[model samples]
Target: MRMLLQIAFIVAAGYGALVAAAYFAQAKLVYFPAVGREQVATPAQMGLPHEELTLRTKDGVRLHAWYVSVPQPRGVVLFLHGNAGNISHRLDSLAMFARLGYATLIVDYRGYGRSGGRPSEEGTYLDALAAWRHLTAERGIAPEDVVLFGESLGAAVAAWLAAQVQPRALVILSGFVSVPELGQEVYPFLPVKWLARFRYATADFLKDVSCPVLVAHSRDDEVVPFRHGERLYAVAPGPKSFLELQGGHNEAFFFVRPEWERSLAEFLDSTRPVR
Candidate 1:
């Protein structure tokens, strides 16, 4: 009987430890100032002049970004990248948007690249807002001239911003419905819905957005399940479109899917402001 009680106690203690670890690990899930090579594409490579930019956040964190200008840019794509890597990791995507006649601004969230500040949900949201302000206030780009393009974790930030700020359109790539939902998916045994600290509840904010939305997800996305993207599209209260492609989390662009580019271009074309 004593041995049985000891075994039960051990099991209970192990379960408690696992729950505690998951709760504390939420903040450590996203790494800032991502490690790896920073790839910058030249005009010849992307068919546009790309300028590196450094902007200051409200809290004085200097964030890194790259602006690529297209000849007759239909609209500007404010590219909020995925959880990992700095802007350099997304040069291919920047080039693709530039080639499709859209000026692109790829900004690094605080703690990513050369940007300062620890990466939390709130911190990333603030970093995105700073990028928006820099383009609109400092560079003279109107809200109507900008499209928010967010990938994975960046999509949550974009959704939150769209709820607050009016933009031409929003694009969510490889995105989840909410951070807590994702946590539950990852740690099915844990009480993620209750324990998650940084709740990037994008689905909750979708109802407040008034602009057109485009959701792109890979059919076989391993990191974020494809259903989350579909669910978000269903909840968004706007003229919305969904594009499903082949590939996994990071390689969705590698297939050079025409639907991916066409959907974005068509959405921008439809939302362009009348002169």
Candidate 2:
């Protein structure tokens, strides 16, 4: 009996230490920005034409973005990428959008790519606003002709902004309901609800978004569970869609090649003005 009691105490103490460590290092775990390898690749390498853009946030942060234009654009796609890699890694996605006849603008959030400053929740929100300003104020694209596309963490930023401003369409790829909910799936033993700093309530925002929305996720996704996408789709009002794809989290686009293009093309078609 004495030996059993000692084991229980040790296990409890070890669990407590792990929880404390998670709280302290939460932000580091959330934002994975590749600092040094910023400008490694360009859209031109993929035989795509793109213009480099410089965005200055209202908070005075300098951000780097790429404006990939199509020959005859049906609408504009303002892309928000995931957390792990910089914009350099997203050249394929950008080229794909450009080839599909939508003007694509992808950016490096603050410290991610060649952009300035450190990465934070509020900082990314400000960076997204800068991207929006570049679209409307600089590029002169009408709000009704702009579509917001986000992947993972970027989805949160896009959903938060879409609540405030209306867009032609919104797309969220493999996003979660909230940070706390995801944390629960990942670290249920820890106090993630209290410790989490980034709670991306995408389902909450979908209630207010007045445009067509698309949520895509894969059952084989190793990172975020597919239920998140389903939950968001359920909450979204009319004209919302949920795309089921194959492959892991990162490989969804590659695995569901034709299906991916078909789904997005349908959405873009809806946005295009009728002749």
Candidate 3:
């Protein structure tokens, strides 16, 4: 009996140590900034008209962005990308929207691409505000004409920002309910609910959003579970739509192009302001 008690004590101590370590290293696990490389290709290289941008965040962090314009654009899309990679990596994806007659502004959060400063949850929220200001305050675009499109980690950021502003539509792809909920799935044995540092409460934020919302997710997603999207849709208030996508989480974009394109155009058109 004594030997069994000693073994149990050892197991408990080891578990405690792991939890403590995870608490400190959580941010590192969350933010994976991509390695920088020479810009060998661009949207223009792919036959799209694009302009490079230098946007400053609320806290003075400079961000690198690209504004891909389409002739007689229906509206503007403020794209918040996934955790990894810079805006250049997503140029191809953004170009698709440009071809569909919507101008796209994809920005690399600080510490990614040529943006200066490290990333944190609060910092990213500030980055979203910066993007909105660049559009409304600088470019003279009305807040009602802008669409917020958040991908993966960016979905949470976009939802948080949309709640605070009156964007025409809020769209999230491969998103989750909250960071702590995801942590619970990843580290079930640990006290993840109480331990996670970043609380990206998308569901909560959506509750307060005044604009239309569109959630796109894949059932075959290997990263974020499909149920997370469903739960989010359920909690989201007025004028919410879901794009039931197929294929893998990352690859679903290619498979769902028809629905993806049709849904967004419809959403934007339905919410288009009278000139």
Q: What overall lDDT, based on C-alpha atoms, would model 2 receive against the true structure?
A: 0.84
* Backbone clashes, each candidate: 3, 0, 0
* lDDT values for all models: 0.82, 0.84, 0.86
lDDT by residue (156-190, candidate 2, tens digit) is: 88888788787888998888898888988898778
lDDT of 1 by residue, 1-275 (tens): 99999999999999999999988877777553446425444444645588878888888888878888888788898989878777877767877787678898888888777676778777888888998998899989999999998888888899998988989999888888887889898989999999989888878878789999988888889988989989999999979888777788977464256666776677778888999
Clashing pairs in 3: none
| RMSD per model, one decimal | 1.9, 2.0, 1.7
Q: Report model 1's TM-score to 2 decimal places.
A: 0.93
By TM-score, the better pick of 2 and 3 is: 3
Candidate 3, residues 1-275: lDDT per residue as tens digits?
Answer: 99999999999999999999999999888898855423446788889888899999878899888889888988999999888777777766777787667898888888887889998999999999999999999999999889999988999999999999999899888899999998899778889999999998988998999898888888988889999999989988978888888777667254227666777678768888888
Give Cα distance to truth, residue 81, candidate 2, Å: 0.3
The Cα error of candidate 1 at residue 241, in Å, is 1.2
Residue pair clashes in candidate 1: 33-111, 33-112, 33-113
